[model samples]
Target: MCIIFFHFNPNSASAYRLILAANRDEFYSRPSKPADFWANNGNILSGLDMEKGREGGTWLGISKKGKCAALTNYLQPVINMDALGRGYLVPNFLTQDMDGLTYLKKISLEGHLYNGFNLLTVDFSNTKGDMMCYYGNRSDQEPRVLDPGIYGLCNSLLDTPWKKLVNGKKLFTETIKKSCALSPENLTQELLNMLNNEEYQLPVTDIEEQGQDFIRPILEEFSALFIRTSFYGTRTNTVILVDAKGHVTFTERCLLKPDTNQWKVSSYQFELET
Candidate 1:
C-alpha cells in the first residue's frame, strides 16, 4: 500500500526486532491477486499483481531469508504510466540475499528508470547490527540507514511531515511503550485500529499538482490515517512481527471494496534462516 509504519530494534534482548503495519491504497478498478505464499521455487510470499502478470511483482513482500521490502510512490504525478513498474522493486529485493545498503546503492544507480519512489528494505541477515534503510530519489539523493526506532512512510517520502505519518508514528511509539510485555495480538490489533483512524482531513487541495483533478474534489476525504473514498481507498492491511529468535508472524486483512462488510483475515507464522 501507499502507507507503511515499522519499528526496528537491533537489540538481541528484545523479543521482536521488527514489527510492521501497513495498508495498500489503490483504485477499485485495478484487479490484484491477494497475498499468499506463491507456489514455485522462490517461495515468495506476496500479493501478485494480475495486471502485470509475472512481471507485475508486488507492492510488498518477504522472502524465506527474513528479507523484507516495501515501496511507496512520491506523490509526483507522471503521465507516462508505462515508464517502469515500481511494484517490481519489492519482489526483486525479496529474491536476493544482499544487504539493505548494498541493494539500495545498486537501485540508486538505476533511479532514473522509475518515477519518484521511496523504498524501505530490512536486512536480518546479520543477527547483530541488523540494517533497515530508506532510499528515495525524490526525498534525498543519498540512501539513509534507519536507526533503531519507529518510522512512518506515506505517499510523499521517508518520514515526510504528513499529518497521518506524524500522528501514526506518535501513536505507534506510545503503543510500543505501553505494551512493553510483548503482547503480540494486542499490539497488532492496536496497529489495525490505527489503520482505521479517520480523524484528519485536508482543508484544501494543492492546485499546483499537474493532473489529478478527478480526486481533487474528494482529496480532503482521503487525507486520513485510513483513506475512505469510493473509487480509491485502502484495499488491504498487513502486519508483520519478527522476533530475535527468528520467529515471524505475518497477517493480512483483505477487503474487496471500500464499503464491504466482509473482510478476510489470514495469518502465517514461519522461522527465519539462521
Candidate 2:
C-alpha cells in the first residue's frame, strides 16, 4: 500500500470500528494475484505479490481472527535490494499469534532486516480491547499505539501531512460522514470514488528540492492520489471496513492488464471469528 487513509474508532458505539482505503502503486509489469482467501490458510485474505522469487508476500492483509496489517515503503533516495522484501511484513503479522504491541516490538528489533517501510498492525481480538500499532523503520520514533482518530500515510512517515495525505484525509472524513447511513456496498463505492481522486499535486519537499532535476518529473507523476505512468502506477485500490459487530467488508479494485485502463473488482465479507 503506497497510500492509505483510515479512521480507527475503537470506542465508538456506531456501526464501524475501522474504515480504511488505500492505493497500491507499483511497476505495471510486476505480477500479482487479486484479493482472496489464501488457498493454504483459508483464514488469511489478501492479494499476493507474485514477483519472481518473492511469492506469498502481500502489501495488506487481514485474518479471520481479527488481525490486520498494511505496509508502505518509506521514501528513500537509495534502497538496499539485498534486504528482505517488505511485502512479507503484512502476512507475517496476520498469520502470527502475537498481539499488536508484541509483534511490533519483534519487528523493531529486526528492523534492519528490511528496507525502509511503514507498517500498521491491528489486533481486534485482544481480550482487553482492540489495538492498533504503527512503526516505521526510517522514523526516529518508536513503535507506538495509535489513539482513536483519522490518519493518513504514503511513501512518507505516518501522518507526515504531505499534500496528498492531507487532501485524502479530508475526502475520507467526508465520505465517512456521508456513508454513516448507507449500505455496505454503497459505502464501499463512495470510498472507491475517493481513492480515484487525482487532483492534488505534491509540492517539492526540502529533500526532493535538493535532489537531481531529472527525478522531479517522476515525483510530479506520483503526486496524485491516483497515479498513472507508462511503466509504473497505481495498480490496486482497496477498501476495508470492519463494523462494531466484527463483520468485515473487503473490496479490491485492480488493473486488469499492465498499462491499461481496464479494471477488475473483487469483494469479500466475513464475520470475525473472535
Candidate 3:
C-alpha cells in the first residue's frame, strides 16, 4: 500500500470501530491477483502479489480470526533488491496466533533483513481489547500501541505529515464524519471516490524534495492520491470497514487494464471470528 488513511475508534459508541482506505501503487507490469480468500489459507482474505519471488504476499489483509495488517515501503534513494520481500509481513502476521505486540517484537529483531518499511498490525482478538501497533524499521521509535484517533500513512513513517498524507487525512476525516448516516455500501463508495483524488502539491521536506536523478520524475509524478503513468501507477484501491458489532466489509477495486481506466471491483463481507 502506497497511501493509507484510517480512523481507529475502539472506544466509540458509534456503529464502526475501524474505517480504512488505501491505494496500492506499483508497476503495471507487476502481476497481482484481486482480493479473494486464499486457497492455501482460507482464513486469509487479501489480494496476492504475483510478482516473482513475492508470490502469496499481500500489501494489506485481514484474517477471519480478527487480525489485520498493512504495509508501506519507506521512501529512500537506495533499495536492497536482495532483501526479503516486505509484502510478506502482512500475511505473516495474519496467519499467526501471536498477539500484535509479540509479533512486532519478533519482527523488529530481523527488520534489518528487509528493505525499510512501515507496518501496522491490529489484533482484535486480544483478551484485553483490540490494539493497533505501528512499527517502522527505519524509525527510531519503538513499536507502540496507538491511541484511538485518525491516522495517515504513506511512503514514510506513520503520520509523517507528507503533503499527500496531510491532504488525504483531512479528506478522510471529513468523509468519515459525514458517513455516520450512510450505509456500508455507500460509505465504501465514498471512500473509493476519495482515493481518486489527483491533486498534487510540493513536498513537505527537503529530503522529499530531493529525489534521485533517475527516479526523480517518477517520484514527483505520484504526489497525488491517485497516480497514473504509462508504466507505473496506483494498481488498486481498497476500503475496509469493521463495525462495532464485528461485522466486516472489505472492498477492492483493481485496474484490469492499465492506462485504459478498466477496473474490476471485488467485495466481501463477514463477521470477525473472535
Candidate 4:
C-alpha cells in the first residue's frame, strides 16, 4: 500500500464506520491481480501478487470472520531480503485465531525479521464489535489502539503529514460528514472517486522519524491519492467499507497499463455475524 486514507469514525451518528481508499504503487511490470482472491486454505479474500519471488502475499485481506487488515511498506534505504514477507502478515492474521492486541504483540517481536512496515488489523471476532490496532516496526511507539477518527497513512508513520496525508485526510473527512447515511454502494463509489483524485502535485519527501529515514517517491506523481509514473505507479485502487453491524463490502480496481483509464473491477459482500 502506498497511499491509504481512511475515516475510522468521522461522526457521532454512527457507532462505527470504517471507510478506506488505498492506492497500491509499484512497478508497472510487477505481475499482480486485484480482486477478492482467496487461497485454498481458507475463505480469506484479498488481491494476489502473482510474482511469487517474495511472499506472494496480499497487501489487504478480509477473513470469513470479518477480520480486516492492510499493510504498507516502511520506506528505507536498506532491504532485508531474508525477512518474512510483510504481505503474508495480513493473511496470517486472518487465518490465526487471535485478537488484534495479542497478535500484534507477538508479531512485534519478530518485526525485525522483516523490513520496516506498518500493519493495521481490525478484529471483529467478538461479534459484539470491532477493535482496531496499528503496529509499525519503524515507529518508536508501541502497538497502540487508535482513537475514533479519520487518519491518513502513506510511506511515513500513521499520520506524518507528508502533504498528501494531510490534504487527503481533510477531503475524506469532509465527504464522510456531508453524507446523510451512505449505503455500501454509495460509500464505495465515493471512496473510489476519492482514490481517483489526481490533484495534489507535491513532491515526495524523505521523512525522518525517530532517527529512521522514510522515503516514498511514488507520492510525487500528479496526485496525492492516485499516482502515475513511467516505470512504477499506482497499480491498483481499493475501496472497503464496514459498518457497525459487521456488514462488509469490498471493491477493487486494477489497471494493466499505467497510462490508460482502463480498469478491471471486482466486488464482494459478506455478513460477519448472524
Task: Report the lDDT tens digits of candidate 2 across residue range 16-117.
Answer: 889999999988888999999999999999999999988999999999988999999877666687998888889988888888888888999999888789
C-alpha lDDT of candidate 2 relative to the true structure: 0.86
* Model 1 global lDDT (CA atoms, 0 to 1): 0.77
List the candidate 3 regions with Cα displacement exceeding 4 Å.
203-207
The candidate maximizing lDDT is 3
Q: Candidate 4 at 223: error in angstroms?
A: 6.5
What lDDT does the true structure give each of the candidates?
Answer: 0.77, 0.86, 0.86, 0.74
lDDT tens digits by residue: candidate 3, 198-258: 8875663532553355357666667789988889999899999998878899999999998
TM-score of model 2 (CA atoms): 0.95
| Model 3: residue 223 alpha-carbon error in angstroms | 1.0
- Which of 1 and 2 is ahead in TM-score? 2
List, residue by residue over 1-274, the lDDT tens digit for candidate 1.
Answer: 3789888986556558888889888877778878889777455678877774435578888877768899887675453565678888888888776888889999998887888788999877554567798899775468878888888988777776666678788877887776567577887788888787887645434312422764465567657777777678888888888887867888888886556646788888888774
TM-score between model 1 and native: 0.91
Q: Give the poorly placed runs of model 4, Cα more than 4 Å off.
A: 10-16, 37-42, 125-128, 203-219
Give residue 67's error in model 4 in angstroms. 0.4
Where model 2 places Cα greater than 4 Å from the true spot, the runs are: 206-215
